[model samples]
Target: LRELKTKIACTIGPSSGDRGTISELINAGCRIFRINFSHGNLELWKEWTDNLRQVSSSLGVDCVLIADLRGRSIRFASPIDAKTYSAGQTFYIVRHDGREGEVPSVDSPEFFEAVSENDVLVSDDGRGLMRVLKRETDKIMVQALSKLTVRRGKSLVIRNKEIPIPNYLSHCVDQILDAVRLGTDYLGLSFVTSPRDILAVREFLDKNGSDIGLIAKIETISAVANVEEIAKVSDAVLVARGDLGMHFPLEEVPRLQERIVGTVTAIGKPVIVATQLLGSMISESVPSRSEIVDVMNCVVDGVDVLMLTGETAIGSYPVETVNWLRRIIETYEGDVRTRREISQDQLVDRFALGVVELAEALNAKIGIYTKRGNTARRISRFKPRTQVFAASNDPKTICRLMMLWGVEPIHVDSKEYDRGLEELEQKLKEQNLVKRGDTLILTYGLLDKPIHTIRIVQLIS
Candidate 1:
């Protein structure tokens, strides 16, 4: 399989959870796996994580596992039988005991108090919306704006209120702790509203002595307002276009995505463009023209990762979705040849860019030796024409580098300069990443050392 600068992250679920199917996904160029903590139990997640690790090890590939935390889902308690509603129907949402025809009490008491008449409540994954016509002490009378099949646990989004969700919801705290114990490479916090939310997760991880990367999902207006502050503290930020669209106008989502990507890129952190990149592929064998255009636009916008949610989780053509996404990214990125330069004021970032420019100008590959993958990320922002071989002994660093653009991470053993370089060169040659007589611009730095070195190397038989 050919590698692209923008990585493909597939959601692991019942559709693609088996060993054989996962192997096919990896062979089809899926670089990362997202284990949603919102759906399954801890036992199921651990099983999936262990299986993913074994599969990646056996296949000799890098598949970074991300545990997506379910933070503050605004659903309501339901009776034994859930009722479905149609357009123009009047439904009632009660905070107390609701009858069979009436809507059940919502999870958050704040939701009932914050919403008023004339406000809109979106449900059915944002496809179904309702307008509140009247509000009483215990119930809200709403007019269905669209037909929807309401289920027991479906979350309702109130567009008027800026809902304050907890950093770690009740159900996700145990999952987060489990993720740290299982050595998950990253944790995706859904519905993040501020920098303090990111810090909350960070504090918990720190208290537990875990170093998992925190990815803040930008799905709310508050998150967009505080995106820069959140990006400043987050390891990465995801443009979760699903709920984000519900919060803002659908036409405005693309611009919001671009804005968030640019902001996070400027901060020198990875930006993931997620949710419905290939939504049509969930049922169809191929994606629609607009979906293809959307993927291409995101790549052009300089997103580090393109993610598939339902397209891979419960889709009929999960493997094909990933393959098609990879093909689209490869074709578009090759044709566009765009460069996303870091706008940081640090000398190290400038040095990294200079090295990348040198490599591009000289038509030489960049050989980077980094322990934490920061140097490689800095270089990747430039989008060099030549390949980037990021060599790291740290497994976590190598795994996390899977999300980086234009980087092919290789794991090395020795920290010694000559030994590590020789091993890395051998691996690259064996893998045909570099050929004999190929020139390389090498960058390396010791973990304790404050200095970074950039040099030249030529391979000869």
Candidate 2:
């Protein structure tokens, strides 16, 4: 099971929020746990973060928390009554109205300016689809394409339209501050369109004296159009197909994902493939064959993380979902094409490739000492055939590496090089992971520090 290179990340919500289930997820191969600030409040955030910390600590596993910030976006204000719309039905949208009937209002009055004829409008996160028929000064008329019960404050997304972002990004800024204060390992910024959006978040984090890793979610056409810039700024990229599908045709998502993943990987940044990996598992114990094929293809595409959102958050089979995901990953990971074929422009990436070749020559497990989790991620870009271990003083660093392909993260506190090695050997022995006469190719340093040499060792039992 430790040889399973691809990592699993599950969202924490109503179903998998408890310690027992969290521990089960860890055992079932979940390396990263996400807490969506969009759905829950600060109290829930505190509870979930504290619970995950407690559970991961109790289980002695390095599990990182992703505080997903819900950025400034559009949503329905509220409705007065139960309003359901079906295909071909015309509905009116007004600004600032919270009634269930009448024209449903949007949170932003700017939405009125953004709407145009023939534009696709998705309400409640794509549950309710509508096509704009006419745009009036105060109200926009849309014909529904699906049946959905509209509710108060349900998310409203205008496909491919540039929605105005609030000053300091509203709730997202507050959530970012909260996540920094809570000591989360990663911050997932929702609906990020450009490098400036990431810079804004970075400025806020800098002001607060926190250097939390930021993951830019590519879910909008603007984001996809500027993905290269976004990927350069972000610590990672999340291929958020749910909203991406809303912006573009659903059939285009797989190709878009491949292009995005390839582009990000070329720069040696992690890319996470998210949404509906095993959606059926939320209800049934088993996933469909098509879901298995999707997981297989994602692994083939060299995605750094495969995310399960509702599958673990509100699903009936949370643990099983993770287990099946891991199983599929392990099964297909070996069949993935060699990483050597991917071209590398960065010197660090070339060095990582060299490490892979050296490890293959020595028939050794690749070992690294990392801070800020960059070294492990760089090494993971090569997708080495040998198992990889990354040791870090920061539990967050260890946890963050959980999603990297072919990398096993271990938490170690020895600052000195010699002490670190002794502790590493002891951990290897205690975990029964390395045995007598096993070869290890080791490197030590932070990303800024130059590693002039790689140390090869034959463990003596």
The per-candidate count of clashes, in order, stands at 0, 6
* TM-score to true structure, per model: 0.93, 0.92
Weakest lDDT window of 10 consecutive positions for candidate 1: 96-105
Q: Write the per-residue lDDT of candidate 1 for residues 120-184, one digit (tens) a residue.
A: 98875577789999998768999989886665556678885776544444546777888888889
C-alpha lDDT score of every prediction, in listed order? 0.82, 0.82
Per-residue lDDT of model 2, residues 1-461, tens digit only: 46577778899999998889998998888878899876768888888888898998888767778998877767676674558987889978777744445557876767887788999888654567999998888888889988877766466788777776656355587788788888898999888778989998888788878888889999887899999999999888999888877777778888999999988887778889999899999899999999999999999877888999989998999999998998899888887655565555566667778888999988998778777778678778877888898887876676667767778877788865556656776787798888999998877654556653478889887
Looking at model 2, residue 186 earns an lDDT score of 92
Off-target runs (Cα >4 Å) in candidate 1 are: 76-84, 96-105, 165-171, 336-345, 417-419, 446-449
Task: Give candidate 2 regions above 4 Å deviation.
Answer: 1-3, 79-84, 98-103, 123-127, 152-154, 166-171, 341-345, 445-449
Q: Return the TM-score for candidate 1, rounded to 2 decimals.
A: 0.93
Candidate 1 residue-wise lDDT at 195: 88
